[model samples]
Target chain A: SAVISQKPSRDICQRGTSLTIQCQVDSQVTMMFWYRQQPGQSLTLIATANQGSEATYESGFVIDKFPISRPNLTFSTLTVSNMSPEDSSIYLCSVDTPPAGVYNEQFFGPGTRLTVL
Target chain B: GIQVEQSPPDLILQEGANSTLRCNFSDSVNNLQWFHQNPWGQLINLFYIPSGTKQNGRLSATTVATERYSLLYISSSQTTDSGVYFCAPTPKAAGNKLTFGGGTRVLVKP
Candidate 1:
């Protein structure tokens, strides 16, 4: 099992303010993913951050809204820029164990719950 | 993009009862995983069964890659099992990215 932690278990911010969520892992991982969960909704993939490369974002999400920084294997940060009340959601960082066979066990951080007032 | 659908969006179970959750995928997948989100919002990995069957404690999962569906069995369910259960499937041609299903919300009353 991988130990993952995210800063700011939760926060309440005014609209238009930006917030950066930090994710730290106990060991080196090649792929780190960011996900979002709106109130009463399932998880949605935001982007994939890999060391030494630009992040790849999924549809309906853009870098201008969520910029990711993967400085190294064990650290990554996600910035929710120009926040709005609609951006209020739980942001989670996930990493999968090195591919062993066809199974890559994925683990999630505690998640940063943000509420824009 | 692959589509994932889980049955019984909401489930209510009594303690010590047995329940099964199902996940259906629209495309062939190279990987499938199950996750549990607790009331505190902590997501925990329950199984990484891409194919075949695997069991741990009172929980077990089986993924039939050929059939494009999976099943999760909870035997003797406990109150702790009350939460949201999610299934993520990765398309065969896609990288390690996971597309999560809407999830099944389970409520276990003791």
Candidate 2:
């Protein structure tokens, strides 16, 4: 398993503001994905961050609202723009490695807990 | 789009007991995984069983791809196992994208 970390484990932000959460991995990975888990709900895919390309967002989500940046193979950043109370949730980052030696499983970070007021 | 379902939305078990968690998918998949989200809210990957069976210490999982269902067995459960268990499925057609289930909340009392 790869070690992943997210900065500012928990944060409280005001409405109309923005916060960028950073995800770093110990080793290079092929694919990185961002997900959100609202209170008392299941996880939802936000976007897939690919190096040197615009992130692929799922339906009901837009780049203008949640912008993603992947500058390198082991680091990525997701910015929640113009936050609202409805955006309060846990943001998680996942990575997929080569499935050669073992069943390549998606490794998740300790997630960033964001609260909008 | 694939649909994922997990059974026993809420469960209360005693320490040293055994329990089974079920995951059913609406479509065939090449990838099926189980995750445990502890009280701390950290998602820990438990298994990557797309088909057949695999075991890890006190936990084991089996996925019947043709049947579009999977099973997670916890042997000799501990208080630490109290948390939400999630099952995610990824269709082979999709490039490793996972759709997660609603999850089953387990509470193991000592």
Among these predictions, the greatest DockQ belongs to 1
What is candidate 2's lDDT per residue for A1-117, written digit by digit as tens? Answer: 789999979999999999999999999888899999999788999999989999999999999999999999899999999999999999999999754322357989999999999
Runs in model 2 deviating more than 4 A are A99-103
- The residue-level lDDT of candidate 2 at B110 comes to 99
lDDT of 1 by residue, A1-117 (tens): 779999989999999999999999999876899999999999999999878888999899999999999999899999999999999999999997764333477899999999999
Query: What DockQ score does model 1 reach against the true complex?
Result: 0.72
Fnat, model 2, is 0.60
Give Cα distance to truth, residue A18, candidate 2, Å.
0.4
Displacement of the residue A99 alpha carbon in candidate 1, Å: 5.8
